[model samples]
Target: MATFCQFAFFIAFGSLVSVHADMKLDCQQDFVSLVWTETRPQVDTSQYRLGNCFPTSVTATQAIFKVELNACKFRKLVTGDLLQYSNNLTYVSSELELLPFSLPVTCVYQRPKDWYPMIYNPVFDTYGQGELLFHIGIMNNDFTGPAESSSFPLGSLIPIMASVQQASHQPLQLFIEECVAATTPQLSPNGDKYTIITNKGCLVDSKVSRSRFIPRQKSSEILGFLQAFRFSTGEQVYVHCTLVAWDPVGLDKTKKACNYVQGHGWELVDNPSYNSLCDCCESSCNARKIRSTPLGNEMVHEVVLGPIMISEFSDSLF
Candidate 1:
């Protein structure tokens, strides 16, 4: 009976040893089999531009380490065809390590509209010179907000005019070359209207020059003229009247054409006493004009004036 018991015990011990060896072999094999199925990660092209691209798939050695380590804990057998096994192994490792190692890939995508430059010129009839200058700078959604303004020195105005003219493929107009102080329109209360008033000294319509340019001066006449023109409350008004000179001959002479055309017919200079003359002749000529507000009661005024240098015009325009 004792002998029989010994034989049974030996048989049970051998079976246990066999099972241990099989488990170790299985664990080693599973770990070695882990691999990456995808060579790289896929990239999303919609968000980027300028030929920018991102990666689609990635092959990583660390991912395999994770899969092997995880399987070791669970004593799980790795299953699947070679390709699928590799993919699963990679996925397992990715989950375990939580590593973010991605390769960037690239592909061509269509360009968006509003991506190109917008060029426009605003001319005011108030200035007798056919083209009064206003410049629009290149803007992008990322770098700048919807509304922006800048001031330039009077001297820089000429070069800026030349650059704008070149970019627009048009001849630089003589008026743009002259130095003039200007203010940007401020945003109204409702955010709808932008109004800027530039003091363009008393402009006489070529047809009715004599009627507006008479020599007699009086304060009452100026006050009356200003009051006669009604301005709605909260309206943005920019007045850019000449402080030192009415028709700036200095500005005209600065231009290349005006210098060469010595006696050109364009009456570049208006009478220097035009402001005083207007104040004396027209009642209320210097009174502020009222503007209506688009927003109920929200009104703001952004005013700028200067003895600005002509050379700094380009930076200010943008």
Candidate 2:
């Protein structure tokens, strides 16, 4: 965390006061954030940007910019054993009299002798059992930062990632059977509930919202985009999802990602050859009559993400 300020003296309440437009930068393990706090009433925050990413949140006095470090076009420099990522935060006002300002920001890491590239770890939940480790996290828009936030507004898109870390070298497939959002962390039959993904991996929320399944990078992981919503006004939202690790070659009606395309009906994201399987999404997707035990590399895990306060005041970040 670093703070940079440009001060200007003024008189307020008949007393001499020093005011400054402060810029705070946070270079975390997973992301980089820049905040510009301006007391000048004439300044427009829409003209400010950190690299190509604009402020996700902005108010009369505060503007916040956040993005995955790798997603932003940060310049990279290697000096001997140290690696640096740098960017500039600039404020360009529309008024001719308001001078522009640019703040140089950089984050550096020490490169180890035997260092190999790896992803940064954020606050994530993990279920390590036997040879498989199942984990889930809420990520940034680009699926780079495993993000955590206390507040989200209605209509904001939330990116989520569920993955499996395996000790065994077997190809595995991941799926979200269903997910529900409630005001409480624990689900109750009487509680206010909104089903997002249902009918065996069908994103039913897409029928009403812009929620959809993201393209898969690997069979071992699944990414999803969920629009933030509320069951009750100003109440906390908790998302409970049923995740399963299955054989990539054995994708069936039960293990799939079906997103409701506006004009195209339901479409399979991972395997289009099984579009017939998604037909059940409109009706009912039944379980196999003869349920069999999961494979050695397959398992079912239940994960909960949130305590996210749904607000109407939060600005859309997407």
Candidate 3:
């Protein structure tokens, strides 16, 4: 069944599972990472042998997907050999009924006729708030020739497989990876709020935003990041200064109309700091911990603090 979402849009999770809540599923942004994997080198693919193949126009992006094993089943397939090709033919049949999300693919032949493996990176778009769950799987269906007359050495299992012609005889495994980047305020299970820090992303930020595509709030020192900032008694208020327009030179955003902010107020300072860390919605922002990867370190000059609530009684204390 299709899930009716906001704006009358619908989403279908072919596998009845929730998107993982631990992975960071950013909004309107794409990241590099393979969140799931399942592979088996040994399998009897005959069970799934419907002995049929489809017009190869299928792809990972398509709404409905089925695995085509003709390309991978044969270790060495001679060209134009239909008998040998059909002998090696493997496809989805009753073996796939148990899959979710049409068996998500990480690798597949780029073309129906081509044998090269193409890297699969699917881009998911949704306005749904909260953790996103994803379900994906892979299967092996190599149904070719007779079991008893096989040339390869497998004396231990020759008698048992004498009757089972074309049946998949391998167990299936499924893996799930979730992202909480869409959760409310992007909260983690351990209570950490994740925020996107512009072109530099979470690790970095630019003095100016390069592309308005991955949009985020622009802040100013005039908005009070250097010193003590106060907030209302008990409300989690998300705030950003209202920008009347941008400067002609850098397209630098400027908040000229303090009166127009509508009680959100405004600030002006001689020393301006483009510090996103110091720009939370409460009394105090969380301290960012940095770690280095083999490629690079966390590029940052300072841990900017913001209007983040330090405690439940932050307003009462200050």
lDDT score for candidate 3 against the true structure: 0.19
Clashes of 3: 27
lDDT of 1 by residue, 65-155 (tens): 2233233222111111111011111111233233222111111112232222132221211112122233322112122222133222322
Off by over 4 Å in 2: 1-129, 289-298, 314-318
lDDT of 2 by residue, 90-158 (tens): 666767665565555666665445543243221111222246778878887767677767576778887
Alpha-carbon local distance difference test for all models: 0.20, 0.69, 0.19
Residue-wise lDDT of candidate 3 within 76-140, one digit each (tens)? 11112111111112234344542212222222111224322222111211011122221111111
Q: Tell me, what's the RMSD of every candidate?
A: 33.6, 16.9, 26.2
Instruction: Write out the backbone clash pairs for model 2.
Output: none
Residue 240, candidate 3: C-alpha displacement in angstroms: 12
**Model 1 vs truth, CA RMSD:** 33.6
Model 1 TM-score on a 0 to 1 scale:
0.14
TM-score of each: 0.14, 0.56, 0.14
lDDT of 3 at 230: 25
Ranking by TM-score: 2, 1, 3
